[model samples]
Target chain A: SQQGEEDPQALSIQEGENATMNCSYKTSINNLQWYRQNSGRGLVHLILIRSNEREKHSGRLRVTLDTSKKSSSLLITASRAADTASYFCATDPFTDKLIFGTGTRLQVFP
Target chain B: EAGVAQSPRYKIIEKRQSVAFWCNPISGHATLYWYQQILGQGPKLLIQFQNNGVVDDSQLPKDRFSAERLKGVDSTLKIQPAKLEDSAVYLCASSLDIGAVAGANVLTFGAGSRLTVL
Candidate 1:
């Protein structure tokens, strides 16, 4: 079963705008990682945030983790058409297995 | 360094037929994992290997699915009598293990092999 659940199943925005996706998990985790997948392709790891960290940034990506609420969010600023893809959150909860969320489909129109 | 490699980007086979996919992880990676991802869903772990030994296969269907990672580098996953529900992408991932330390768990995944059961 999937331990993480992403909200805003689908989102659409114009190019140069910002997009935000949220994920919630059921258990404590050692880390939460985000990935992006193009259509019919493999996933690309974006960023990873440790449980003790509250926020981290990578270029245009910003991720926030709140262990108390068991939730996390990924923000993509200055979105572009090429940024259209599915974003997934993977939770590593004291196990080797990474439980992934359903994912958020973001479409950035140029 | 080269990323994880997988063969036969796509495969289409009839039901009840057998199919196999091969994967070679990046050099020096001691941990390997196989995951099955269905369309519109997240990937699920099928099995995991630490070196040449099985670390986890709790989710694998022993009846028709089997995997081997001999020599602790390359691995293969085989499915016999494939079912309609087995049509999905098989992803291989690997991570480095440094001296039995439990902190090195980040995984680098391959492009994956897509299977279509007819």
Candidate 2:
């Protein structure tokens, strides 16, 4: 079963604009991770944020987690056309298994 | 480092036919997973393995799907008498181990095998 659900099923923006995507989960998690998938391809791990940490940054990507609200958000700064892809948030709820969200399709127009 | 590898990037078969997919995880990785992703949906875990040992397969359709990772290395997923609904992308992923510790269980995924059952 899917534990997380991402908001804004689809979003389109021009190049250089910041894009923010939110994910909500139903239960407590040890960590939350974000992944990117290009059309007809496999998923690529972008970043991971542990429950103990509220936020983390990797290059142009920033991720924030809120265990109390069972939610997390991914921010892409100065988005480029290369950033066009589907983003998904996965949660490991006290288990080795990771449950993925439905994902948000991001389209960055050049 | 070379990433996980998968075979037969795409496949198409008729209902009731059998098909198999192969995966070779990163070197030394002890945990491997197979996930099924339908169109417009998230990838769902079908099974997980830890060094040739079954860790979890609660979601797998045992009647039609079977997977094996012999010798704790390469793995294969097979489906017999496939159904149209079974058509989807099969993703293979691996991790260092099944240790659930934060920041230590990141998974690396392969390019995935797209299956189309008619």
Candidate 3:
């Protein structure tokens, strides 16, 4: 069974706009990670936010975690055309295994 | 360092036939995983190995699917009598270990093998 589900299944925005995607999981997690995948390629790890941490930032990517609500959100600021891809949120639910979300498809139009 | 490597980027087989995909994880990585990703959906964990030992195969269809990680390094996943529903991308991922240490369990995925069953 899937442990996480992402909202806004698909989003299209201008290259300079920001894109935000939300994820909700069913159980408690030790950490939440975000990844990006280009078409026909493997996924690339973006950032990971531990349950104890409320938010994290890397480059233009900002990830916020709300353990109390079992939710997380990823924000890509000053998005670029290269940022167009599928984004996923994976949760490590007290185990070594990481369960992934349904993913959000973000398209940046130039 | 080189990333995870997978073989046969694409494959096409008729239903009831057999097919196999190979994966070579990053050197020194001890944990490897196989996931099946159907179109427009999230990847589902099929099997996980911790240094040649099976840690989880709960979601694997043991009846037709099998996998092995020899010498705790390279791995192979095989499907006998494949079905049309088996058409999807097989993704291989690996991590240093299953350790609980923060920021150490990130998985590095391969390009994946896309299989098409007719």
Candidate 4:
């Protein structure tokens, strides 16, 4: 079963714009990680924000975690055509299991 | 380091046919995982292994799906009597370990096996 839900089931934006999505989970988590999947390929880990961390940045990717609300958000700045893919949030709970959220499909047009 | 390897990038079979997918994780990674992803949805955890031992199989459909990691370095997922709903991409991933805390490890995934059942 999915651990959470990702808002904005689909989003379309022009290149150089920014895309943002939110995820909300049910249980307490050790960390929250975001992954990106290109069409017909496996997922690639984007960034991870530990429970104690409120925000983290890697390149154009910025992620924020609010443990109080059990929610996390991923922001991709200056999105490119190659950034078109599905973004999923996976929560690492105390049980050693990583359950992924529904996912947001982002399409960046040139 | 070589990333995770998976075979038969794609497969198509009719309902009730049996099929299998294989995975070889990066060297020395002690944890292996199998996830099923339906189109337009997130990947779902089917099973997880810590070394050669099964750590979790709560979401696996026992009636038709089974997996094994005999040597702890290689793994396989088999589906007998596949159903139409089983059509999805099966992904294999691995991590170094559980770490001092249970769920703190990051996973590296394979290209995935796309299964299409008619």
Candidate 1 colliding pairs: none
What residue runs in model 4 are displaced by over 4 Å at the alpha carbon?
B100-103
lDDT of 3 at A79: 93
C-alpha lDDT of all candidate models, in order:
0.91, 0.95, 0.94, 0.94
**Separate DockQ for every predicted complex:** 0.59, 0.76, 0.73, 0.79
**Docking model 2 quality class:** medium
Q: What is the lDDT of residue B19 in candidate 3?
A: 100
Compared with the true structure, the alpha-carbon lDDT of candidate 2 equals 0.95
The native-contact fractions of the candidates, in order shown, are 0.57, 0.73, 0.68, 0.77
lDDT of 2 at B24: 98
Question: How many angstroms is residue A96 displaced in model 3 relative to the true structure, after the best TM-score fit?
Answer: 0.4
lDDT per residue for candidate 3 within B1-118, as digits (tens), equals: 9999998999999999999999999999999999999988888999999999999999999999999998899999999999999999999999998873554479999999999999
Predicted candidate 2 versus true structure: per-residue lDDT over B1-118, tens digit per residue: 9999998899999999999999999999999999999999999999999999999999999999999999999999999989999999999999998774434588899999999999
Interface RMSD for candidates 1 onward, in order = 2.3, 1.3, 1.4, 1.1
User: Compared with the true structure, what per-residue lDDT tens digits does model 3 show for residues A50-104?
Assistant: 9899999999999999988999999999999999999999998877898999999
lDDT of 2 at B33: 98
Docking class of 4: medium
Residue A41 alpha-carbon offset, candidate 3, angstroms: 0.6
Give residue A28's error in model 1 in angstroms.
0.7
